[model samples]
Target: MVSINDNFHCNGAYVAGDRTIKCWRYPRSHGSETFVQGVQNSCNPVFMAVAERLGADRFYDYMVKFGFTEKTGVDLNGEAVGIIHKKENIGPVELATMSFGQSFQITPLQLLRAASAVVNGGYLITPHFAVKTVDENGNTAKVFEYEKGEQVISEETSAIMRDILESVVSEGTGNKTYIPGYKIGGKTATSEKLPRRSGKYIASFMSFAPADEPQVMCLVLIDEPKGVYYGGTVAGPVMKELLSNILPYMGIERDAEGTEEIFTLMPDVNGMNLKDAEKILKQNGLDVQIRGQGETVYGQFPPADEKINAGTKAIIYIK
Candidate 1:
């Protein structure tokens, strides 16, 4: 892993189309970022450098170690085993591309199984559709047996990875999927389909919540989405919605308080004192920003009763 972050000039060493291979740091123009930031931002070049160092042999070994080379051995029948490239076909370029999760193909089920091991302390788990079996008379018959597979990654490595993944949600590309009260750690992937499939895209986000104590893992994938097919934009919203509903139903207590409410309507702050307006906005989970220097509020952008999502900023003008 990168111990530090700095500028990395690709210089067309690994070119795709007309542009040099590099990470696109969105919203910001240009600067250096930390290693954790790279993971949070889903920086490709940062991972590509690591892949180049690992080379084909070690990289392939890690893939096998993650159970990517074989079936997940789930209880469901007809489970699809993902495909990995042959050893001979894994060149430097292929390895670099695969490092950021491209080129090779894997099923959502396979990914979930591997990801579970990564967060569950390195033990490859068999996903089951049924927890317990029922008899014809609605009596309990048998509970599903679970086998703890060998550790694919070390405990220390898993902990580090969990921390890094958590940053992805809290500080990185997956920030859009973050829920206020939950500690979510995840990665977003935007995979391009082959030309044979008419160059479509699959936007995906995979996450586990309460990083220190993971209760559940979820994956959301949108195939061939129209307009803005980014994992953080499309699939991230879906995962956020699912987690928002399911986490509470599971009776998992939130890590933070006062996060259960959803703010859809912007409250009227006009004609009220600045302090009172700010207080009301805070109560509704909106951040207050003031324009002009007066104490009494004059106007507010988004106005009154406008539809807005939670976590949106409210700008109030005071006279």
Candidate 2:
């Protein structure tokens, strides 16, 4: 929760109506805490200050800049755009409340998009579970294309944020979500819903891999879970499970000289960029067949992060 508050809480005043924008300041380490450790301990006031320093308008701009206000128009059913109350819609106390994920609501997809942007080099992307769209003739087309959804910050800023999130799992409140071998980066958020009055928490965990240059990302949310209700303890494990089941399924290599000696079948590379995806295949002594002119990699025939048999043709499409 401290990590959430540290990243989300803020206070500020703007020209009231401008959409164009901008945005920490962290917890002191007086206790047995280190850099991110202070924040990971869920030190309320510290994270609140971080959010306060970021201010509300800039944070709200980030929300829009990251595609939270729009529906993303994905093919998935029952999609909902995150609803954030703007300046006029909220004030000092309200904004501070929002700093820790209060006074706001976002769907699973919306949250995933925002978190993905942070881990994906500050580029917001349309989240899609399906691989591609197929025509009646069986000719396939890419479903979503990556086109710089929005540049929310400099690459440096994203790198810093990624490190802080990684610290959350390595040594902070979210330590429970840490996975061995894979350099997992993530943040935890636990917020109390309004009007319920009975005190229920919404737990969420967002994560990615190769922290430096994330290849894939994920978000998990657990509603009204019993006993311990925190982003780390509750949502972190779910996030871990998703990766445990999905990463091996994706066929990502574990050896240092990956694909050097043997070639494996491709799993799924639905959200990867073409150049990056192609590199993996080329190094594996495999071939690629691209079907479209899309610049963003939308889907892979054999898929990604998975292992495969020798001499497999890995088909990938970009937007």
Task: Report the lDDT of model 2 for residue 153.
Answer: 68
Regions more than 4 Å wrong, model 1: 1-30, 134-141, 196-199, 257-319
lDDT of 2 by residue, 1-319 (tens): 1232233321222112232111111222233334365456554444445555667787677667877678976777877777778767666565656665667777777777778777777777776567678899988866756456667766876887788878878777777877665567887788776675577878888888767677778877788989887778898888878876776687754444434444455655677777777887777767778878866787777756576656777788888
What are the Cα lDDT values of the candidates? 0.79, 0.67
- Cα distance off (Å), candidate 2, residue 104: 0.9
Q: What lDDT tens digits, residue by residue, belong to model 1 across residues 222-245? A: 999898978988898899899888
Give me the displacement of residue 119 in model 2, in angstroms.
Answer: 1.3
Model 1 accuracy (lDDT, Cα): 0.79
TM-scores of all models?
A: 0.74, 0.63
Q: For residue 176, what is the lDDT in candidate 2?
A: 80
